[model samples]
Target: MGWLWDNAVTLATIVMAAAAVAALVYAHLSITENRAAERRANANELWRERS
Candidate 1:
């Protein structure tokens, strides 16, 4: 469509922004998961030492 062609750049920019946001969200979730796993490991180590 003529309107879509005229706004192609705008559409592309929006798509890129959305993708960047998604990447940031994924990275944050991964960091949180890693921290949780590290905490669990640390607790297990402490338990073993105590026992």
Candidate 2:
């Protein structure tokens, strides 16, 4: 476990990078879901106007 203590900085950097990637992915999914919901609402409004 002495090696782990010596490489703590490297391990922390990797963990930080993984967290950043996960945050980006979460943001992307949230944006996509919002866009899809907006499109559905728009389609419904258009259908109602046509009817």
Candidate 3:
């Protein structure tokens, strides 16, 4: 791992940045899915109540 030793700090920073971006993407997608589920649930309840 000569390359890693040569650029340890930069490599670590890059890895951390990638992890941060991934986490943000995951969180955004999870929130979107949760909101969609909530909407579906509400719609079902409304239809059930009407019938």
User: Positional deviation of 46 in candidate 3, in angstroms?
Assistant: 0.1
Q: How accurate is candidate 2 locally (lDDT)?
A: 1.00
| Native RMSD of candidate 1 (Å) | 0.5
lDDT of each: 1.00, 1.00, 0.98
Compute the lDDT of residue 45 as modeled in candidate 2: 100
Candidate 2 Cα misplacement greater than 4 A, ranges: none
Which lDDT value does model 2 have at 30? 100
In TM-score terms, candidate 2 sits at: 0.90
Model 3 misplacement above 4 A: none
Ranking by TM-score: 1, 3, 2
**lDDT at position 30, candidate 3:** 100
Every model's TM-score: 0.95, 0.90, 0.94
Clashing pairs in 1: none
Task: Give Cα distance to truth, residue 28, candidate 2, Å.
Answer: 0.8
lDDT of 3 by residue, 5-50 (tens): 9999998999999999999999999999999999999999999999
